[model samples]
Target: MITAENLTKRYGKTLAVDALSFSAPRGAITAFLGPNGAGKSTTMRMVMGLDRPSRGSALIDGKRVQDLPAVPRTVGAMLEMGNHQPRMSARAYLGWQAHSARLPRTRVSEVLELTGLASAARRQVGSFSLGMRQRLGIASALLGDPENLILDEPINGLDPQGVLWVRSLLTHLAAQGRTIFISSHLLAEVEAVADRIVVIGRGRLITECSMAELRERAGTRATIVSTPDAKKLVRVLREDGAQVESELSAQEVVRVFDRSASQVGEMAAEHSLRLHGLLQEKVTLEQAFMELTAGAVEFRDGGQEPSATAVPSAMSDGDPQ
Candidate 1:
């Protein structure tokens, strides 16, 4: 398991990472999520010993990563892309990593194939596309057959197929009892793959829980109903203190909030109302994430507001006077 205890970092007067702590267990994909400038990269750097923490510790199996005797064998991290030697071929690069870690040369071939880079093994790193480069970087990380993996934006430029491959690969790795900790901006993909989620904002822990638990906290579901007795149903639902709204303009469809489909159905039966449709719209993980991090967004667009588009005073009715 990977554990972080009060890991903190500061740059000049700016506290990049606050006292943050979390644990990622083995046999599970733990997703780290945050908006831009939320200290995700800083925290990952601290964990990998690339950056020093102003205070606290990042422990891998009870020891600092820097103190690991066989660093690559214990942890494999792809913190960034485009960090490879431009002129070196993919095969040569993996061979270099293998040599540094004193691993058998055949291991390079294994990872190349495992990461679907066997065909491009002889291509120069500089000639590879962003997606191919991402694959090559992952191959380097797997070169050591480490028990833990830390990847940052691994699917940054991947196509649909590439993204699926990554999702499946992470799932397979975690199933093998390896610790998989990932940070990504792809919420839909994360929702589908992550077994646990840790969200941080402004360098502090915002919330951490299973995917199901986090959705439950969102609690903004609505019941969609299509009934012939729309007027009566709306009145009855409103009397029950449920917020009802039209689902579409000039349509019989209505959405009832703060209530479930079953509740609406039962109410309809109690009053002998004919129901054509009834369904509940559950909160999606993406919605929950947005709501949770809305206040914590560090950077926002500086564009003019909608009201700012109003006609200028000199161009208005009084201007010609």
Candidate 2:
């Protein structure tokens, strides 16, 4: 497991990471999410001891990562594993990692097979596709067969098939009791794999909670059902401090935004109204996460909202085409 407390980091005049604290539990996939320039990279670097924190501490297995003996044996990190030597073959490159880390030679081929790169093991690193490069990075990370995995944007350039492959692999690793702490801006994908979310915005912790808890805090949406009596119900609900909206169906779906479902249920009973349908909309982890980070994102400075147009493009494909 990884634990960070009041983790702070700074550069010259810029505070990169600000007082972040969270526990990445074992036997679970913990997702780290943030907007651009939210200090994700810096925090990861600090955890790996590639960078020092100006304040606070990040611990792995109950000890500071830097203090661990042979950290590579306990923590496997796949950060920006984009570096490559054009002339070096994939096999040779991975072999070098084994040599440097004193990892067993047999483990290299195992990771290659696990990442589906055994077929291209002889090819030069520079000739590998972007997807292949990501696999290679993952291979190196698993080389030590560490108990912890820290992957930053593991699906960044993956095609749909590659994305699914990565997801399954991470899930399997966590199932075997490894602590998987992955960072990604992809909400829907993270929702599937992550058991918990640690969100940061503008270099600070927004909230850390399980997927279900976050949605509960955000409140499930209620579809207001109405007819001509909808107007009366809407007014009554409004007077009761409930939020109501008119629907395109010529019906007003009463949404008790902050009200509990039980409260709404009780209110609906008291009205003695014959309702068509009273539905509570399910709030996905993505929506709840977006709401929490909405105002604090570093991407917006003038308070301008992001275009809804970008959401679709950012979504992972429904299936591999």
Candidate 3:
């Protein structure tokens, strides 16, 4: 398992990561999430031992990353794409990493095929497209076939099919009892695969829980009622203490929050209202994430600039997508 105990980082007078604590257990996929300037990248770097923490610790299996014997064989991380030599072929690059880690060269060919880069294995890194580079990065991380994987934006440049392939690959790896910790802006995909979520904002821990727990805590369920008498229904629902909202473009549509479909239907029936359609709308991950991080956003369009103390200097909190 990957665990952080008050993991903090600071650059000069600016604090990049606060006292953040969380864990990504084995046999599960945990998604690390936050908005721009939320210090996600910095935190990941700290966990990998690439950046020293100002306080606290980042641990893998109860040991610090640097203290772990044969670190490459124990954990594999893909923090960014396109960090390889541009003149090297995909196969040659993986070979170099495998050689450095004392891993068998056969693993190079295995990961290339696993990441769907076997056909492009001989292509120079500079010639590879964005998606291909992403695949190569993942291949390099899997070169050691470590039991724990930490990937940052692994699906950034992938196409729809590529995204699906990644989803399947992560699922397959997790099923084998590997710990998969990834950070992605793709909320829908995260929702589909993540067993737990850790959300941070402004360099502090916001929330961390399982997918089901997040849905429950957010209470993201609403009922949609379509009727010709939307205006009257809205008034009645408001009088009955139901939070009602209407679609500006579709006057016939009304959304009632914190109420179930049956409850809304009964209310409509009691008021002798004609309902054209009634259905419950499940709150999506995107909606819940937005609600949970609404106040944590560091940058906003046409919003006031944050005070100097509120913004980090040396290391901007924004993840360079």
Best by lDDT: 3
- Per-residue lDDT over 8-108 for candidate 3, one digit per residue giving the tens place of the 0 to 100 score: 88777777788999999999999999987888998999899998899999999888889998888889999866588999999998899999999999999
Q: Candidate 2 lDDT, tens digit per residue, 1-321?
A: 999999997665666678999999999999988766667777887888888889999999998887889877899998775576668998899999899999889998999999999999999999988889989988888889999999988988899999999889989999999999998878889988888899887678988988778776876666545444566666667889887676544654555565655665667668865556666677887778778778655445688765432111111210000
Q: What lDDT tens digits, residue by residue, belong to model 1 across residues 1-321?
A: 899999988766667778999999999999999876677888887899988999999988788998999988999999877689999999999998899889999999999999999998999999999999999889988888999999888888899999999999999999999999999888899988999999987778999898878877876578999877888888899998989997544558989988888899999999999998898898887888888888767545796342221211221110100
Question: Better model by TM-score, 1 or 2?
Answer: 1
Higher-ranked by lDDT: 2 or 3: 3
The C-alpha stretches of model 2 lying farther than 4 A from their native spots are 224-279, 301-321
Q: Which run of 10 residues does model 1 get worst, by summed lDDT?
A: 312-321
Q: Which rank order by lDDT, best down to worst?
A: 3, 1, 2
lDDT of candidate 1 at residue 111, scale 0 to 100: 96
Query: Residue pairs in steric clash, candidate 3?
Result: 37-317, 37-318
The full ranking of all candidates by TM-score, starting with the best, is: 1, 3, 2
Candidate 3 clashes: the total is 2
Query: Cα deviation in Å at residue 88, candidate 3?
Result: 0.9
Q: Count clashing residue pairs per candidate.
A: 0, 2, 2
